[model samples]
Target: MNALRTLISLVFAALLIAVGAFPTGAAAQIGAKSEVHTEQVQARLLAWAPQGVATGAAASGAPGTVWVGLQITHQPGWHTYWKNSGDSGLPTELQWTLPPGVMAGDIAWPLPKKIPIANLANYGYEGTVLLPVPLIVTPEYKPGPLTEAMDIGLKASWLVCRQECIPQEGEFALRLPLRSSTALDGGAFEAALKSQPAELTGAQQVQVAGERLQVRISGLPEAVRGQALELFPETPNILLTAATRGDAPGPRSWTQRWDGAVWTADVPLSPDRADSPADLPLVLVTDDGQGWRADATVSGAWPAPAPVAAMSPALEAALAANAARGAAGGGPAVAPPAAPAAVPAGTFTWALLGALLGGMLLNLMPCVFPVLAIKVLGFARHGDDRRAHRISGLAYSAGVVLSFVALGALMLALRAAGEQLGWGFQLQSPLVVALLGTLFAVLGLNLAGVFEFGQFLPSGVATLQARHPVVDAGLSGVLAVAVASPCTAPFMGASLGLAVGLPAAQALALFAALGLGMALPYLAASWLPAVARALPKPGAWMDVFKKFMAFPMFGTAVWLLWVLGQQSGIDGAGALLALWVALALLLWALGLAGRTRWLIASVALAFGAFLAQAIGPAVLRGAEPAALQAQAAPAAGERWQPWSPERVQALLGQGQPVFVDFTAAWCVTCQYNKKTTLANGEVLAAMDAARVQTLRADWTRRDPVISAELQRLGRSGVPVYVLLAPGQAPKVFSEVLSAADVKDALAALKS
Candidate 1:
């Protein structure tokens, strides 16, 4: 199945290139437009003429100006920053490579809206927006031919943000018609021009008094006289943009008042202010979205710049590299830092503590208990040997902590490179799921006494374990995390979410804390005198107990197989089970003596290999991702439909409440809720009474959309239940949910 998915992806990529469906930087000859589609944004270079201007003109005749704009359309819930991105974010940048005779003007940025993220506020645009630029053709330019086109090349980069920030870039080349003015997308261009903030023609004043930065405007448009207004500063880091409390929409962090003809606003100045410009440029917008720009004269001395937290060198380097990647061959210009959500003070410490507690609680979860049980049994065998027990425990803790840090680092690096991944990301890969299932199945067989290490191992090799008992304990810790981390036990989700937004050093510390928490209990059992004394003495019944433990191992294997079915469909799961059977048979045969054993093992190995190579591709070809199928054909009698941002918005627009279940097949906690509280009869009745829409965002497979939504809600993993009511903030449930939780949310919806 893994091979099949990889092959399909490769084939599609090749097909896109062969058919010219892939974006290219080559000059577009057919139309005066060059477009590129990044993962979350669709950007294009458009050429158009002013209204009433004739498109027909001699190629070598007159010098005229045409309008060219970089038009960007963001996916729902995503946005790109404006020139002055308040709080944090990088503005869109364009690097032009034009003909000697042609020149381009600065981007005519349209008025931006305040985008609040947690406590921080950013200035940006959502939906579709065009940044128009003027292209001037001077008399110094000589036309080569009557039919020749003006070649324009552009290299552009932008930082797009939803819950997280992604740095993206594209190269575009447009061949504008020299013989005639190109007026493509003229309506869009006209609308964009209208959206631009009109320059103020009235007197404006700016004065600083203590902590307040006051602005006064003498003349105001009658249309916006008594309405509430939003102020957008053109200068960065001059005013405080972080909200005082939550993300509830309201006026700015300061206050504003209207004195009939004159408008007055008093906003707090940022303590982190490092610049004091003579003229403070600002844009004021009314409730009706009309805007005017003003450059008010400075009237007072600026305060001292506050001491700020120093950014880690690694973070600084990464930002530098990201900026370099976009500006590679385009000159010395660099992009502004990609400002993700800032980590508030004490966030790291809180998250670390949460991660540790969550890790300790993980031992009680069904997915992890079996592994920990085996460790406990081993502790009993060690009995009174405190030194050996302590050594083994330390080794195991080291393994667990190191493994967690490694995984966290990888996740962070991948996210930095623009992969929308979260916790339990490994389980998203079919290959990893298959491998873990096989490992658990083999362990089950071994525990059940179907095969013994002594039968197959050379004498000296088998004794290696006795000489290095800690090696076995350490490996067990690695195995436990592989199967258990996907559970996302209580208190873990928020910590993991916070970790992603933190600096690398702090994030890794949180992961290590979680591992330490998970290992603390076992370490205490091994080292503490009273706890060690309480352990059961080894007896002849130990063999029987070991075999009994095999059942739990088998159960885990079965669960993994079921998860595989959810990802690769039934055919993939069936193939995997067949392979497991063959593996068991081969292991048994290897334990036997003589040529009969060799013959059986040889045949088993060959058969298993053949099944993997031949049947795997066929299974892949016949089956689609189970998540897609489940959405198309929901389970019998289920009221839930597949989730999408568009659907949620549409439902909310119609005055309906929404309940979204962010889940995945591998997430055991999510399944528990699904079969329990979410399915409770009383809960369903309440939901029906309230007409609450239920949408399931299945993360059985790698889904960027669901990932983004989870990030937006400040969660890094699944089992997230969000109840969104119109005109209210979304209410996110705890990791463990209950019938009462759903009922109460429904009750609130009704209220």
Candidate 2:
């Protein structure tokens, strides 16, 4: 019951936050003319008459209609869509709230240009464009006192695009007084009206001819008889919007031929077509911006609809909520809210550099230290064998590179299959965590000389390792990556984040770069004769050195156990500890005499297998619901609170500064920060002084919400530090955090 309740809470919070988490790019005070600005565009609501207008004063008389235009000014190279967005975009939407009897007409869409990105063609407007909507004042509206004015509120949303897409919105309220009209903005409105497509009085027909859509029209303007005309379909999914080859403005999207008076075109229909209509609506625009609208009868049936692609759970829920909200407000459904994908911080070259540097730095992290120490011991063991050292180094480098590529490929594949995942996703599973802990324990025991595999194995099996010395080094590289990848180094966060959004070939290249970087040090040590000479010669003290290195492996195992405790609670940790004792017994039994060894090994193996079968599911599946919630909660008197999208948004809406720590227990870097800088009293005092709400987003478990939020910020792992102030862009901190970094960020938030 508690589990079900927790699920319900998560669902409700996700849906509720979807309404406002990514809403309204800008805010403004209500007025006769209101303007809101985003990074890429400016949106303004303007009345046709700037000064007040009295009823029945104009020649048309008696307060019939007034025009209000939503004007959008785009930055160079950016554009917003028309009523029907072609290929891969969403159309702008307007929802109005007005006084009784004042109804709003649909937007008077202007002529759209074919804006192309890569090979996809989009129907949208560039530069500056005004969408005019008429407000109809019915007889039911009565004139009030002289001071009375009409109040109109509008919520507008649009998707702007260049190389990437950004979804933005604005809320505006306008108050128009009852007085005389000045008509100051009349020219803008008139221009928009002139740009509107003229209704066609010509013969228009459409037929589905196999895989193509055949459209025919006649009675165009005489001047346009021999001129090439551009076709803009009003109804979506009727024809392919992407070109057959090359980018836009190159080859014509559709084949066009004019036979003197009549115009005819054969365009391939969309393979993923989702709509079929009896009437086909299209707009034909000429070179001079003059356009004609045609509503033509269809003569044949559309092809069978293609299977729809699945949506992410977050998107699916957001769409459902949008539909519900639209029904409640009695308006058309608006576009779903979206987190603006932050443009990658740098270019592909920079990303590759970051990945390379990040991988090199991973050698310094504690989680990876144990593996490096073992590799150092191996180098010491083979100090006199230069050829062997070089061969082992090559094998190790190959292992690291191939392992990183395989892991990167799997992550990409899962993401393509609609899983909201990120780097270090493997650590989210308790089973993987348990298995890694056991593997480390075995390594620690071997290093400590508890049992050697060769002592018990047949001569044939034991000699296999002696025959292939490089295999051991290769396996060590794989083990290093398995343990170290979770500790996201400085540049790795951004590089990994950007990688997930890039093309497969490029993304995998970045991953391979990271692996190559990690292997560089070992390769250099093996290849450089001077570096090898610098190493201490092997001696009796080497055994003690090896034994000392065993402690780090044991330490790593203990840390993994702590991480498991965080994920599955104390009981699960205890269960694993019991399994470890059985494992130790089996290892010890291998060193005993024949009969005793067999007898004890038999008992130990049976006991370990039984325990695993009985408690493995319970431990690996994680803690009970109550325990998980309790773990999520902050301890007594702690300033930090558990994070949710709604919580962060609610605090921000109240003008509160918020600091979010996107972290996980398995992340070694995250644990270090939590123990050091984040726990500092001075940092806490500064945050409290600024009244910043501290939120801890625990990603110890698989959390789709946190994963989605991370992707939005262009990060694939923790610890991600985000400082957000109301009405300001978010400030993201580096992965290697510090006390001074916190204080500086807080101080800036105050400033």
Candidate 3:
């Protein structure tokens, strides 16, 4: 009987151990319920109600309303989300269980800080936050004694994230003695309430079109104008966060500016949302960390979408970082504000006129002189036929205008696609320069009577027919533009710069006007019978003149080859010369007869292919030559340094005056300035005395940075001179530089 009783006791002990080890679902549930009130469940996040009183009464002064606070403390590096969690994350949620006749209001969130995780940006809070909630007490509540109290229970759920995320929930209860009057001190909760964005008091207007939203506010203090400020949208799904415009406008971007008493902002709406709400909430924060909240109403009809220009990659990256910083409630690097439409009223007209004048001046440039001579000879051939001359003139004008338009369109298209190109950008390519050089060489040989192209063609193809005078004139116009591109004459810079920034249609019109101006002289000469009669009759002298013209063509070819060498190095230039030789040999073989000619042509073609294969990679690779480096390096006693965006910014930051020369070796105007004005000892002496930084931006080869800078300055080509005085907007000088110009700019800096 004793052994049985001991065995039964052992069995009872084993059963008790099993019950403790594997509890029932209901028991586990009860334990979890009890653990909700404990602070140790998730140490990373803690939720509690701050000790406070019903702050007298609500704005309505009703007995039913009382303001309270729910405080949350997060561990280091851990954070909870705001109403709108940018990029990713969920917002904190709270559910309240109250007695009869009691209600809870929405959480009044304070301004959130931007939390960046790798490349992703989020809006949340770190450290401690107090969320204010208005509790409504009904009039039916009876006045209670000290032991009688009101029970307020809150169930809080939040996601705490630091590199990883953990979901946490807690139940909190607060017991407060019933009272008619309550005293609440202005502590953390009061400070948080003060930090909340205030409702906008002034008139506000919002405009929305497509994905863009713009807001204008009036009655702002004049002092706020030009101050660094950031905008935050409280409306979820409308905007994740407002991007500070800083100085430069960005695509799908936000920018704000205060115009004296009124402030205007341009905000890009989310692409995923449709139909903007009539009412919007916004928070405006100054650089000093002060914030104001306001609700704005949409007013005005949606405007049509404006054409958006592509921003440079560098600017885009900078703006993105700026936006992130702004979201994080940090001061962002501001760019100089976009100068109020540099092209004002009547500016377009002036630009068109300038383009015309510049185009007319282009005729006097050395590059265009060769083409002009050919046109003159062609004119002599038709001096007697007034009708034919008139028709040819019209055809030539059409060709010139159409070519300019085409070139402008191509440039605009490329710019839209983010190509940092400018005037004569085609010449930046070694292949283009080579092809142009070869064409000039062939044309020179043709003019020198080396071989007639007509003889090589099958038949019915007139190589140089005077009967088709219109065609001849049109071809002449094409040639004129080809050579004219390398030279940027007076008035061209400003006009082209303006054109580059204008609408495509307007830009094309400006280009056409320039072409018309260039063609005007020839057009007038052709149309006017008296001018046509003044020309000397066609004679053997014409042949002599044509041969004379071949020398200039050859000269142009040599210049192009030199330019190519500067771009592709000496070895690449040598390869080009060999290719030219092979091409000449092929032409010679074509002029010969029978199997021997075919064999020679075959051999020439093979040699040309080999040369091309050898040179193609070198040209395409675009390796900077040692010679370029030597040229870029400052010479002894020279004050000029190579231009770089960083160096410019550094000098400007140090309050040093800078004189930048945007130039290229191939640009005749650039070369002239370098030799005549920039190289003058007096100018150099003045620059040295004034301690002005001189920078030379060489555009001999395609540099996207330089190209983008030029675009920013409203220029499309070389020979741009800018004088940046300390703490002042850059003063642009005329493309044609002079000693007086340099001295005046320096004197202005002193003033």
- Provide the overall lDDT of each model, using Cα atoms, as 2-decimal numbers: 0.72, 0.73, 0.65
Which 10 successive residues of model 2 have the least lDDT summed?
Answer: 624-633
Candidate 3, clashing residue pairs? Answer: 64-137, 197-293, 198-293
Model 2 whole-model lDDT (C-alpha atoms): 0.73
Candidate 2 similarity to native, TM-score: 0.42
Error of 1 at 395 (Å): 0.7
Positional deviation of 484 in candidate 1, in angstroms? 1.3
TM-score, per-candidate, Cα-based: 0.43, 0.42, 0.42
The parts of candidate 3 lying over 4 Å away from their true place are: 1-342, 463-468, 594-596, 623-707, 710-729, 732-751
Candidate 3 structure quality by residue, lDDT tens digits, 448-501 = 776556546544444334445556667667767876787888998888777776
Candidate 3 CA-lDDT value? 0.65
Shift of residue 105 alpha carbon in model 3, Å: 77
Better of 1 and 3 by lDDT: 1
Cα lDDT tens digits, model 1, 261-372, are 8888878887667777789998988766788888899888877777763333433343354345434632222222243454656866778789999999988888887788
Candidate 3 residue 108 C-alpha distance from true site, Å: 71
Q: 618, model 3: CA deviation in Å?
A: 3.5
Which 10 consecutive positions of candidate 1 have the poorest summed lDDT? 624-633
